[model samples]
Target: MAESTYTVTGMTCGHCVASVTEEVTKIDGVTGVDVDLPTGAVKVTSAAPVAEADVRAAVEEAGYALAG
Candidate 1:
């Protein structure tokens, strides 16, 4: 499996984490999603390397922003 770490902004609660997780998990090849609310850290595990743009879009769709 491949793993990638990203910083997500605007997540404030469990619902935010759930939203982010749900959107990210919908991506192709994504095996799992772990979100750290305190740190805004999102770790994505996938069968292959996922594109940053795809992840960004997913985060946006969840009403969050991907930190640069």
Candidate 2:
């Protein structure tokens, strides 16, 4: 599996985490998603390397932004 970590902005609670997780989990080949509320860290595991644009779109769909 391939793993990637992204910093997401505007995530403040469990609901935010859920929203982000839900959207990110929808990406093709995504096997898992884990979000750390305090650090705004999102870790994704997939069967193949996921595109950065796809991750950005998913985060935006979840009403958040991917931090640099």
lDDT of 2: 0.98
Candidate 2 stretches greater than 4 Å from native: none
Candidate 2 residue-wise lDDT, 1-68, digit = tens: 99999999999899999999999999999999999999999999999999999999999999999987
Error of 2 at 48 (Å): 0.3
C-alpha TM-score for every candidate: 0.98, 0.98
- Model 1 clash pairs are none
Worst 10 residues of 1 by lDDT: 1-10
TM-score for candidate 1, residues paired by index? 0.98
Q: Please identify model 1 stretches exceeding 4 Å from their true place.
A: none
Q: Per-residue alpha-carbon lDDT of model 1 for 1-68, expressed as tens digits?
A: 89999999999999999999999999999999999999999999999999999999999999999998
